[model samples]
Target: MSATPPPYHQTAVRPDWRDLPDGLREAVGGRLGASVVAARTATAGFTGGFAAVLTTATGARVFVKAADLARQRHLADWYARELAVLARLPADLPVPRPHWALDAAGWYAVGLDAVDGRTPRLPWDPAELDAVLAGYAGVAAALADPPAGLTALGLPRLADLARSDILWWEEVAAGREPVPPLIPPARDRLPELVALESRLPGYAAAAPGLAHGDLRVDNVLLDPAGRAWFCDWNWLCHGPAWFDLAGLLITGYADGAGLDAVFAAHPAAVDAPPDALDVTLAALAGYYLTAAGPPATADPASGAGTVGPGAGPAGGNPAGTSALLGAHRRFSGEQALRWLAARQGWH
Candidate 1:
């Protein structure tokens, strides 16, 4: 395994929710009742802006997502689509009940039955980890057969997306501005990165299934009873199961041994193709390279401050980019590179 990279900053751009339009407040009050109190922003990072807790007069707490209207229409669209998908899911699925949603005004708000639980911290117990993974597997199984009349979520297929990501990295290596190093090795091994792109299609065709495109621990909530409620459906799409598994493992959940245990516990995921892992690493790399940057106060609509000014705030801070890239290297660097090398066919 390659040595892990150094720590980097994780600066996230947060939008002030007090800046939301008055119509949005009226819409929430009308739908959720007049006594809705808006809480501070709960999430900070990436597009779609941030989330605030809306407490109703009846004490019902809902989450309101205010997105960058211009740059992240996809997030607003995803929220609506996810609502539809959640509505079709089995009533028994361990997910938050979608009470209501408003898609207009560049805001996506959904009322969820609040689960009184904290985000599980790292170095989790084996039992707890098993429960979380099992919960994910259960959700995937329940939604195994998507409902009819449902259009495929417009997310790019994972393998194809991975190939595209590697090419982007190569472009960065070729001195493309604003495409700095998330993981420096990616720049050092441009040929291998290119190879990864070529070999992706074969793997993509071989294993196809429903996947939670982003399945990190942060997106899941584990209740006191040990059940995990997966949230953040912004990236759900059709892909291999291993893509999800690899995401879980690579994002600092399980190591090689831990991943083995997860697979052993859930035999249904046994046949998850290796390419799924490759895509997972590639996706992580691509996201860091593309989205991670200095805190951009730029409205996503204007696309200004999208990358921020300077080589990032101060000092040699890599911020979100380094943390993300370091995670990939620490958890799955060899696997990531092997996938890249296989694609490049440059031994």
Candidate 2:
């Protein structure tokens, strides 16, 4: 990452307390054991899901997320999966605890103990980044030998998922997809990119364990005590610990931190392959760059032209998701690529 990095903030179009249906509101109140007095909608993340910190008449505050079961079944399923994952996490970890969940009035909602915290400020606060890294160190240590209960969930492996979903350089090299505009310098280097990303599956398989598959700054919360609490568990998977460390360091790299020293000093980097960081960056760059490509115009399912940003493709825009997701991906991809280029002197 350079002295300047792409913006990490996201402005979501979320529903307010008043927008919730009567039945849904009552259901949430019942779960909280009191009537609601005030609500503060969260401004982070790239989703349209109902996410807020609600204050009850009894002065109790809790975080709640709801999705319309009928209109956003996929989002509802994600919420359900996250609830289950949160329930199984170690009690002492900084991750939130899931208290309860309910289905009411065609909507599914879950409640969690709210933390008096805010997302980490960008430009990489040294103390805040230290807190996030320290917190993630503990998470990685615990997941290195994941509890049997979490393993019982039979979560997908990152190797398999990456091979299927993240390896887009191969597609670009074979002419199946267009080269992303952000990487015109990468046109002649697709083969090298492919080779770099190709090593990820093997490296991941060699030291397989639990990983916070989506370990980004937005997914972390810094408490008043300066502890980092990880959030958004729907993408949990089995992978190498260094994978999360690398992802976390992307922002650090963009913040102009001495990442080589920072990465080597981290506990998660122990026993990691010498080239692990490059592999992870290559895979991430390919994933984000390809995902951030121009929106599809044809509905692959119907073979007809479609409208909107995420219209027609295998991973096209789905309901209840954020529209700014593409912008986020583009920014992330550019950061990863720039960082990788700097490290490898590809510039």
Candidate 3:
């Protein structure tokens, strides 16, 4: 079984509550109507943004994430976009509710209902994975036909996003990006990979719907009752309903789960193309491989190889500047490629 890369679980070096600017702190406290009595910094995911659960003297708690508007403008923009997306999301959706937002003291911050839960344990806890899959079923059903209010945000089409920002096979085939050592067969299979990835846009447009866009284990919270709450709304987009399911199952594939069976059983797969999973895997593998970064021939302005929270096209990683993120990307990409290879009997 492919193990989750340790780096994926420890990418953040989050700032403590006290490390925040005094002005920003004061503003947050004012908005919450109480000074923070205790703060527990969250240390998950690949961003250096300030995220924590803050408790007031009255025991009121809120999960807050903040970014310095000047130094981390990309993160700030992402935060702003997330808040907007959350505000527009369906009320019954299993996402945290935004409590408030602040744009003061050169920082942008938002408070959300603190989830009394933790990130799902890796290595595929069967029960937890089941809960997550069930949760996603609801998400897919709800978003299959998004309301005008939600779609009004003008999310990018999955096909357009994949073509312009996500896919990377063409770059690799052209020798613009390095071939990852683990996927040596990719050198010979470049033509097939490119063809599979090239089909994503047309496939996506044929069955378009709103999608979670960035559904990873790190972005899910398993509550005490074992319900999954999806987070990170900045990547929301107009896409095939099955897209997020394919992305979310990558870890399952890594854990040696029967991902083919799982994918076929998912409600999101109802109308998906017979080869949709293959196409998506190829595209995502390409995304992660290049997202690991520093490909000399990649367009400097495209920022395709970089990591972190800069939105590209509509929104995505502007640069893969973090070593931790690079490691996670490499691990994810390799796993995806390996899984696809196995499915295609590519050895």
**Pairing residues by index, what is the TM-score of model 1?**
0.69
Which stretches in model 3 have alpha-carbon errors above 4 Å?
A: 1-3, 7-9, 252-254, 294-306, 309-322
The sequence of per-residue lDDT tens digits that candidate 2 reaches over residues 96-211 is 88999999989999998898888788767889989998999899998888888888888889888887887788888888887776554554677888899999998887885799
Ranking by lDDT: 3, 2, 1
Off by over 4 Å in 1: 1-18, 38-40, 68-72, 103-108, 149-156, 163-193, 253-265, 274-283, 286-347
Which residue pairs in candidate 3 collide? Answer: 306-319, 306-320, 307-319, 307-320
TM-score of 2: 0.91
| Model 1 C-alpha lDDT per residue in residues 35-123, reported as the tens digit of each score | 66656555423333556666767777776665545665555566676676666556787776677876556566666556555455554
Model 1 pairs whose backbones collide? 9-319, 195-343, 195-344, 196-343, 196-344
lDDT of 3: 0.79
lDDT of each: 0.53, 0.78, 0.79
Summing lDDT over every window of 10 consecutive residues in candidate 3, give the lowest-scoring window. 311-320
Off by over 4 Å in 2: 1-10, 183-185, 251-253, 295-314
TM-score of each: 0.69, 0.91, 0.91
lDDT of 1 at 165: 41
TM-score of 3: 0.91
